[model samples]
Target: MIRHDTPSLMLLWSLLALSQAASAAPDTELTPIEVTASPIPSVAPLEGQDYSASRVDADGLAVFGGPAQANPYRALDLMPSVNLTGVDAYGLSVDQNAMRVRGIAASTYSNLAVTVNGTPSSVSAGRGGVGNLFDMENLESVTLWRGAQPADVGLGMGNLAGSLDLAIKGPTEEAGARLRTSVGGDGFHKLFGRIDTGTFNGGSSLFVSGSTSESDKWRGEGGQSRDTFNAGFAQTFGERGSLEIYAAHNRFHRDEYRPLTYAQSRDLDRYADLDYNADLTGVATTDADYYAYNSQHFDETNLLARFSWALTDDIQIRFSPYWLSNEGERRVGKTDKVMVIDIDQEQYGATAELVAELADQTLTLGYWTQRLSSMPPPMSQKVYAIDKQGGLVFSKWGILADMGDRAYESPYLQLSGERGRWRYGIGLRYLSFRIPGITSYDGSGLPNMSHDSALSMNPAVVAALSTDAVTLDEWLPTLSSRFELTPALDLKGAYGRSVGNPWMGPLYSVYMKNRKAFQKAGIPLQQLWDDLALETSDTIELGLEWRHGSLVLTPTLYYSDLSDKQVTAYDPAVGVSYLQSGVDAKAYGAELEASWGLDRHWTLIGSLSWNRNRLDDDIRAGSAAVLETSGNQVPDAPEWLAKLGAEFRYGNWNLTPIARYVGRRYGDALNQESVDDYATVDLNAVYRLGKVAGMQSLEIGMSVVNLFDADYISTIDVGQDDARPESIDYYPGAPRTLALSLSANF
Candidate 1:
């Protein structure tokens, strides 16, 4: 049968014909592109590896490399089941356009807990923010959890759905090394490679990667660019254990775009240059005087040691200890704009976990500890950098010594038993926090003299603690059960209660804390107000999965009753932005997913979800606005979401095209202004040719996002007096984008 992805099929046929025409002169081997790279010819699950759920490597569709986005998570922005929220200015930098399954995030971007081969994507930021997305070039396989969580995993802040894991290739997977280089659309270039070799009793792997890229900011007033470096290694130690170590560094040496007022967008080009305009409206057409800004510069290193002891054939135990260190600095343009310079930061921490299983039951325990410190120069020495460039330059002025140390231990006791076809388990977790204060960054410069202003201030935090230090916490308990009603039908349910301790980031505003320091110097102290309310919630999930001949389906229903919800508030009196205690809230939703094997050459998959959540009490932050829309649909939460796609394979050919839909969402929780819904389409393909051509593989693919140009708003900031809901200004989604890429293997 003919395929809907005719273009991909055509490419596949052409490639096969080309290979037939080329005659190879006999001595060297030619590699195929689609063949996966792995050195170990024999495979077995490594003992003590905490591998669990696997995620679909749906991101295999990206085509663009370098200058254009060429990574997996970045390419899946329009994939089905994903509600990537941000659309307007600095979408990548904002946390709103996050990834989740059934509306449940992995807590911070890295916390989602899917273990493939045994590593989880770790994010340096918290749930309220985003950092550099994972680099896809280093991955061997990517898989998302189908929903049944493993026995050894736990979630404290963001685990409700499942997790996604990636299994990177080991040196044993390949006997030699491979390297690639690319240059592209944005002023971008990158070089990366991997090498593997086997030695006495085991194997070793080494990898090095680096890239630099930048684009003229859409607003034309700044440069949206970046540079990055990552390197790592993994090795085995006889039969006793295996160890892996890695280090990564990223620098967002780009320009900062000040969020604009509604009025600004109405007069300037979407992302234009402002310097050419005779009038200054704080808006650029396509080109303008841009600032040299630096927000996050990080140096992170990690080490993992896995050990196991076999007590007997039926019983065994394993322990894992890990360590991590993070150091970064932020600097806004000392030129055209006054920016926040992150000149002070150095953080370190470690975590450990142990697992044991006897018969059908399993027991596990985990503990985590952390420390953070940052010291900034005094403000009197840094106000000149903010006026002309409007940079977040104030970041260089605050200091914090939050002898930050937080520790938590959760132990799970699981019992496996069947009663009339029912299997169940009970779990109890003891969690706590002792995080000291966190530093804040006030983008807008502050007046050295006493003055009343509305702004978000980075507060200086100089305190320390140990054991569950960030959020207020107590012990938590949970229960889960499942019933196998029939061979093809199973029902599972869980109910639990958890709390979120206020992360140090929201606990102290450096600007507010420094007010006392300023007042001591004859300056007025900003009036300060902080909310320290821990969120306590009850959650229940009921789900069912059914499998028939060629089809598998699953449906899950969830409800959460919450109190003291946390949300952002900008204070005008002290010019600070802080997360304050909020009124009660309720969230209820349901998710449905299905995958069908139409035939050996084709398969169909789809997912849909609906949500209803709102605040029960009023909430307000800063001079931004009063959030009095009680019972209003939550901001950034859509009422309906759906995505459908199909995959087809013929010989060495593969083709996939997907469609996704997002429902209308309230732009603001307190206002009637709204963001319209949108639909996007994408396509991708890959082919392999090694069986007849020796040991070589080649892969070429392309994808088009926002296939149809759709005008939609990602975010809207209209609270300032000069801006209002009635304004036509908005942050626009991207125009149609096309990407292509090629890869070869030996």
Candidate 2:
């Protein structure tokens, strides 16, 4: 669907054309400015990244505390253009947490990519908790890209919105041990320990860590529990080569919270305590609402390695390989029966790059490939029906498929250079996908439904479907440049194209539920499957950074034109929601961040962002009706966001407080069913104990979440942007909670 003569290309070329004229001017050397004081948890564009990027390190996570073993998304809540919502204060609920970047939700079709140490994790495909693998204590840095990313980065499934990468802190050079304990309201308890072997003979080190945590839901009868273990080993190979290997395992179980309707959100005092029934009524229909019947369990393990060597002083090569194993099950109590979904899958991938330094320029050739079990959900799910007596019966298969040559591959080349006051990079990447084909079977009528029993039973074949063997490929190009306009001022611009793989969640859902309807309407499922296309987005951005004395400021503006954007729309003939493409969208926004050191004891930070995302046109609702959805704002995308915070330091005591505001947003495509805006304040304070109890250092910390006891809607569960008002569900924000922790280092 993309053409070289499009206006998007014209606009990009016009801006890039200025680079040729500017390169002709004589280059001048500019002096760098030095700032003595800055805030502890600060956000600013990364230097030399050639994009709208920001990074936060360990110090930032320490100053902005909520949970001792917080997830990766929680660590990035302080960054600009990031909105994360969780039903619990500690971010313990894996299924209830949601994140959005630049008006695009992370779990749906409009999604961004997430990586761990520059490699994509299989758990990040859907609404999975991939961040739980490495907690804040083990993370070295988290980098965020809001616009265009370099060719060397990994884009899992999609990157139309943005991308985030978490870097792990490997084995330390010194031998030491650390211990931590925490206790909080609602029966919360956690313990963490780590031991580092330090560098020994011939430059080698090893480390291991483990944690156990549990917490009770504030407004429900159930709770959440989790256990995690991580280990790493590193060794140096002379002076030009090094190797490091890391492994992580995590398991968790949690009871889900009941969702409320629009009427319930209008009056919180009466419906605030509404939840799943604590005890079963014994009646088959009533027992379906039992709290214990609606829960989930997940267990995942990952192993990754990195190898690097220098063939020569000017040339180097690197390789990264990873393996993932995941298995889980979700049980939800329905009207008359309990539906259980079981999943088990595995994935393997690697990335290789060759770099050469030529004079003042650098050239890189990179290739990445992965053989995945499946796309997105990344699991073959089987559905079951359970009765009130706890007797399990096979109902139907949610999704069943074999790995038939399903793989992803990308090759890229980039050239970058810095000359005097100008820095520039040009790159091109080719992405190709080999979607798997699937076959459906009629299993509901079988007497024996176990995996082994069902195979021998040989249930009738219902239908065979697939995206065919067609290999979808796209050519994406990027251009970026940064110019030092003055000694203390710099200007930056970037242009790139990003794409998303076809979403199969809705497609499978509709096919399983309404296969007969397709036949009645004289439509072929194969035709519908073949019609799916990859979503694409073209973006352009301009920004500037200025520094003076003890203060720094950055402002940016960005525009994105999306083509064939995926959305779940209703099929009137079948009376169901299905995956649909070819929806055009336009998003434009502006962001600003500032930091100032007023004095030796006081440092302040603030940020503001505004986004306007809308549909460019309307589409057919049925055979004869038009939806009239043009010019409507995207659902759940808040237009305005603001954050303010300050840190105060005095001797051994340090205190920080921050407040965040999210503007109103709609729940449906027509801009109806609006949600109210809300603000919450959080505080963190830490005290150093110097040397005590024969330990090198000791510290005590206290954290307060939602300090004001704010009562507001935290997230909306509409399933899709085009959902009707009656189908909308809301989750209330948690009230004020307190947590205290103690740590010691030896």
Candidate 3:
């Protein structure tokens, strides 16, 4: 059904058309034309910033061999010192999706700050809730700053790791529409469409797009479904001034999958979920029924507006305002003491920046502020009893658990200047946190007489669980500088101090009405809060950059000291988990990246990273015992990582192959259990069809991931009590997969 020589014929026709246009006569009566001088290269080295950064443009994004419906984070894995695991080619059915930077370990709260169009996108500490909010079809580029965040970036928390910025695509100058469809293994399928309105109505344009996707689990017993929409509008006002607005909404639902222990994974059939029969009793059915009766649902909406104006020939001003809302819930089986966790949040923020040219130097001043609040309604849990059929039986009435209003206000200021071969900048950020109050009631939204009677019977517990209004404040600062060594090289360094505030989940636990239950289990409630402290880190970095005609190389070395690191420890006596600030640690590493353009049709890219981390003090499990983790390598910190890739293009076809290697890692702070290293290869190809049967443009592509089908551990449950042989701690990587996609533009 296809011809190999058709591409050559199309190319011949295009050359003939261009030649004919060149031979046509020009209009002699037109006024003389004027030419303007060319501007400087946009990618040139900056004078005032000292940090490791990378950018993946639209053209580079197209070469990724992952699934068609994969999230943006999947592409970031190619960058230096970045790793993501526990997802298939489609980036769905994630059992342990975790992202780490440098040598830092992933946590319940994320350490990285993620943003879209200069607006914060991450709603929690450990994850980026907005990573899947927009369709990839509408993205222009993704930029990552690895070590120290820029002064102008506005994030209330989680900036200690780094930052990721997503820039949205702008409307095209010409009107057009596009449709795309994809299919792959594991019953995966997706459909997407977009429309762009050309410039009209006094230099204004608009675009809108939507997509839907669904896929069967690659190796588990469940599946995932997602729907998303995006819209944008841009308008030009006064000379050298413009305004733009963007909005997005997304909904996601998926079944939950738990990890497997090393012993259980020996039997591949039992790697994902445990099997159980309803007729069994007294069989400890928690793990067996977890997968069958657990699921999660999420809904989010984002709105942002940006404005830019040129006040004079050498002065400019910019402003951006945004609003976001999120609603999420997780449901579990009735066998557990807790049944559900519901979250509702609202956030709004604004940023203003001014730039001026004075005394042959560029100066910048900016301010950012935001308000965030989380207000969830009352929650309840019921007592469960097993029936003869092995099903859970619960009473109609349930106990109440209400989380009160918690809010925060963040403001920051930054100043920077660049002149000749020198650049410098400094910034300061302040945070004000408030916890108002807490309340409790029955499942029917009324006072629980039984709970009140119990509290009266235990007066000491009542006094300990009383809520109080509290406020906390913190300050952070950063300084950076750069100097040019020669026309082709530069030297840079920076020093930064940042803080990580305790998330609301842990703070709210201090006022839990069920404190008596935990105390009875030997997890003293007062001890959990007595040692709580804000996490802080100081970092120093030095780097070198060299650039030539078609090659660029960068190498960076850095060290970080962390104090009062937040950690969670298991209490075997209570059979529960408690939070504490347990240890001080240090991390040091080197990152190297290079790119060479062999020719117009051949290119090569590679990167290498080496890291080392260790605890400076012994880890204390509780007041009476110590884990003896002093001088031990931090868990989950890999010593070496490498990536290599090449691209080739000829006529209408393009091909790329990439390889990644990960070194061995430990699963516990004491280095008792080690996970083996692994490597994977991926290949991708694309062909373009020009002006085929009334279609303006058409493209077809195929991708193969994990070409060798390597078996490896995708991620480990860090800081686990490895002494327990039954602890499910490892997630298996996905097997080899193939996918195909097609798109048409008109």
Among these predicted structures, which one has the highest TM-score?
Answer: 2
- Arranged by TM-score with the best first, the candidates are 2, 3, 1
Model 3 scores a C-alpha lDDT of: 0.63
lDDT (Cα, tens digit) per residue for candidate 1, span 279-386: 233332211333333333444444444445555554545554444444444443333444333332344444455545645565555554434333222112233233
Give lDDT per model, in order.
0.46, 0.73, 0.63
lDDT of 3 by residue, 75-106 (tens): 66667787667655677543246666776643
Pairs that collide in candidate 2 are none
What tens-digit string does per-residue lDDT give for candidate 2 at 195-258?
7889998789998877777888788688887777778899999999999999988777778788
List of clashing residue pairs for candidate 3:
109-125, 109-126, 110-125, 110-126
Runs in model 3 lying further than 4 Å from the true structure: 1-49, 93-95, 106-108, 125-131, 154-156, 265-292, 333-338, 375-406, 435-466, 503-514, 517-531, 569-577, 622-624, 719-728
Task: Give TM per candidate.
Answer: 0.72, 0.91, 0.83
